[model samples]
Target chain A: MDKNLEKKVINYGEAIYEATYQEMQRDNNVFAYGLGADDPKGHYGTTKDLHLKFGKNRCFDTPLSEDGMTGVGIGAAMAGLRPIFIHQRMDFLLLCMNQIVNMASKMRYISSGEHCVPLVIRVAIGRSWGQGAQHSQALQSFFMHIPGLKVIAPTTPHDAKGGLIASIRDNNPVIYIEHRMLYKNAGYVPTNSFEIEIGKGRVLKDGNDITIVGVSHTVEDSLRASELLKSVGVNAEVIDPISLSPIDYEIIRNSVMKTKKLLVVDNGWTRCGFSSEIITDVAINCEKITCERLGFADCPCPTTPSLEKHFYPNPSSIAKLANRMCGGNIDWSPPEVVQHEILSFKGPF
Target chain B: MKNQFDIKKAYYLFLLIRKSEEKIIELYNSDKIKSPVHLSIGQEAIAVGVSLALSKSDIIFSNYRGHAHFIAREANLDKMWAELYGKSRGTARGKGGSMHLNDISKNFMPTSAIVTSAIPEAVGYAFALKYKKKNSVVICYHGEGATDEGVFWESLNFASLHDLPIIFICENNRYAIYSHQNTRSINDPIVSRAISFGIDAERISGNSTEEFFKATIRCKEKIKNNSKPQLLECMTSRWQDHVGVTQPELSKEEENNIKKAIKHDDLKNLENKLSKDEVLHIKKRVNKEIEHAIKFAEASDFPRSSELLENVYY
Candidate 1:
């Protein structure tokens, strides 16, 4: 990597902040609000300088009432304005499920396209620092289940900037889930306003072996695991599904056809998640392909680090799982596998 | 703007709503409509009174029992009935049945089935109206049962904190589903709760559409000067069940109270404001209109399978 060239790149959080800043400047109708939005930490730096840049009227903090505040956002959207409502943790989104699941998603259909609710709900998924069950829940799968709502979990800095701008511009309610750990991971991102199309997926690395599909943080791990598996006599293709609802299954199916194997990973529970969606698509399109799913255990997220280690999927653990499917030797240690934090987040939120 | 207060005209609107709801109850067993219907039969005056105060440019968000508001806002009766009939000609294109009826062109929002959900939504619309420097005001109407929901308090606090141009209209019919509010709610009345949030609030008789209309007009004036949220608690009664087209199972005393209330209902009182000839003329006109609306709904075609995904997104 060229050191001087690398200086132009930004991380996931910076991309998100820049996307919001640019979109607000582009359209006066776009405003953002939520709890901790105006706090000094600024929603883990994803919303840094937004309040100062846009003024208090545009970027502001809200009360702790999730259900009420979410409904407020919905109301604002209905009134010929675009709103970006943020939830610091995806876990707290459970408190406002009625508003999110029922009202926001059904606004357009119920109004016969008379009301176009252009709104975006940004929630931080995945975690670090023992946030426990209350602070750690990946709700992308849940949002994907909803019909009218669009769900996107952008993993890289470029996708963060492009995907968010797309969601802000999209004329429907979009649930934007960002994995907390991917915020610190740096990647190439343009400074100008751009959009990655909704219901589109990007292939990170192409290989002849089994395809590894991932969402949010799992995509980063899949990318790292693919590189490790290549070192061993196994080559794995890695795909990052940016959109969960209105998913682009064609990308995964195309990859699986060439690879003849699949491994699906998600930040949410393995039982009936986006992984299942991928597996079902493969089962329909492709024939006789071996596949496996990897995700968190089906229970509340544990607090202790030792238990937390078992809770999350790292590159090493994913590579180990991949090797079993592709008939490769298990390498307990790989210098390429990241041993440090992928999220680059330090928090007390 | 002191417009002519037409007693016969007001009764005509109320009769249209009453008969429309009655038609829904009669046709509900016919199995033409799939979704549940929440009728606001005797409580039409509250919505008619308050909504008549609003301009077509203004917006309204309402709860489950929204037929009265739908009619009060002057949404096409044929479309509303067609929506219940699951026809593409419906206001919401048959996507929303009784509870979710909306006319976007009329600036009436699709009603939320969840209680207290639309309260914050109205506040948000108020926030947008103020932000855009528009003169429009947003009003939210919900049943008394919604007052117990935490979102109701939160929305009031949010509205007052920002001084948004909104009004919250609560119809205290005293029952949430089957439970009477007197048995289930807090000792502090809802008006006091609104005042606690720094919102100006008042409690008045919902049986009088003229009184309710006057109060809402005054509230709109206050909101016009300084954008802020206000609350109005209307003492009303629902003659029907919480949902569906059947009569509610009430105690003998409760049933008697309803019967007595209906004897002096807004329509009966409102009739006294007009002559016997004028009242008969209005009733005849309203009945003809209701019959036309029924014929229109019955003739409208159900949605084709191709429309299953229409308007799911913009």
Candidate 2:
């Protein structure tokens, strides 16, 4: 926001790539690696050309050994090195749950502060296409439930760059979630390296009628919904909680206090999901508040576009929910506008 | 190839580990030490030999049954005793008990309770050492049961592919808790499995401290000189239960096997090499150290209740 600061317009993936490049250049102990870290596609371009720039020692591909490789990163971290272990899809993280949950997360506690696992596990959440069940999952809630891990899901290019740099420097294990749909969305990011404080939320757009909190890609939907709400004179406040684990409830509590109404939109399921957590926090801290939650329907994700659209909550649905919470006509529906990112998505990566 | 001074030191260490675990078995029933202990009674030689062969700068990642490895590294006896007693002054501040002992200054990394959990971590450390271009090798110690996990094979492949400077020592005591290795795995030797991964590997008797020491020396040299990983499947025996101090009931054949193992004890063999006066001196010194450690652990206080969440983060 500084007038004198230099900035460039880059997409979410490029922002992540820039952060990794800058961090590796700044710290010799920092390195990036994964299954496709050195592949031509470069893990959806976030890790593109990193191997060439940092050389094979610092940036390279790993075998299809998630559990082993994850523990390897954890070990490297304890031995005075920072490793960024990338996963092509969040769904595959299940393979290495033992390393992440039992080892990396507990290293500091079990060692009694003698060791710290400063490892970054970068995973992308999938959506659209026929990616289906195993290929697509938004499991931030699972990581967030664990005590020792710090989970972050950055929506914009700015936060993606800043959040990643912060995660790399953090002494605890950090799960960095990037929604695949947000990759092509461009935003103004600072040319210089920066760190967004972990466990902080940003007010993407300010209003007063109803508080709308979003997670990951749903933040974009919330922003668009806010615009639709404005036409109907229902001013909705939009919040993006970048860090999922140590969530900044104070920000949401403040917004909800003024608005006296809350609607949480999550990118995953509603049952035992992140939305439930946000709603519970606000409900506990505030009085006389009305709240509702939206996410994927409680079922396996269908592959067809028609069924998929119904499964996911979009801008129009979010706007209607906010409109109803603000005492507007519940039957009213806004014009359906397909997001540019969704329309431009070519195929399954 | 063994000098008199090195042989004496190795004997001293081997005897010390034996006496320390015997002391644990003695004090276990008193209920002072809180954690469940996995006794490394019969497998002392592997840890003793491997520890003696490695340089001071080399590192070790061990498993739950790590008392021998911890003792062989010459870590602070007082702190280790305090940790087993759940005292504040212990290593890991009493958070990690018998299974999770670690002395980073001694380069004995924290051991894990879950089997096969620390293999890839050791590989990762080796990768870091190689990346930093440090001339140090890591020794990863685990039971043969660890090979049952898929991550074990995965770690072996990764280490071989990267040519990491590491040595994997499988203490094949043959029992995973109550189940025998024959029931869990086929008769295929673990050394051949390692060789299949392109790592130079060999099998040696765990009861012979000198043989294990020589094998480990060769493995360490191969790792440091060629920057490749090696594996040693040390065939050994366990004298106690998988956990706790209770010895399991054995059949007639099992009893005879145990008697034979005790008869061929490496500690006794090492003692035979030393003079009576030298053995007496070593036993007296080790007994005094153990007594002092026990008193220190008894006197140390438990961690303050407020300190429970101190190290959950950085």
Give per-model TM-scores.
Answer: 0.95, 0.98
- What is the per-residue lDDT of model 2 for residues B1-314, given as tens digits with 9 covering 90 to 100? 23222667778888888888889999999998989999999999998888888888898999899999999999888999999999998988899999999998899998899999999999999999999999889999999999999999999999999999999999998889878888998889999989999989999974788888888888877775785689999999998988998987777887788889989998888898999999899989999999999999999999999989898888
True contacts kept of 1: 0.88
Candidate 2 lDDT over A1-349, as tens digits, reads 8754889999999999999999999999999999989999998888888888889888898899999999999999989999999997999999999999999999888789899999999999888887677767889888988989999999999999999999999999999999989999899999999999999999999998999999999999999999998899999999999999899999999999999999999999999989899899888899999999999888888878889888889999999999998999989998786788877776765
Tens-digit per-residue lDDT, B37-124, candidate 1 = 8888889899888877888788888877888998888888889888888888888888888888888777888888888878888888
Clashes per model (N, Cα, C within 3 A): 1, 0
DockQ of each: 0.83, 0.85
Name the docking class for model 2. Answer: high
Highest TM-score: which candidate?
2
Instruction: Look at candidate 1 and give me any clashing residue pairs.
Output: A181-A343
Fnat, one value per model? 0.88, 0.80
Can you tell me the DockQ of model 1? Answer: 0.83
As for candidate 2, its clashing pairs are none
Candidate maximizing lDDT: 2
Candidate 1 structure quality by residue, lDDT tens digits, A1-349: 6543343499888899989988999999999899888889888787776889888989999889899888888888888789999988898899889988888988888877778678899998757677888888887788888889999999889999999999999989999988777777798886567899999999989898889998888888888888788777788899988999889999998999898889998888988788888898889889989989999887889977789878877787888888878876554565546546633445664
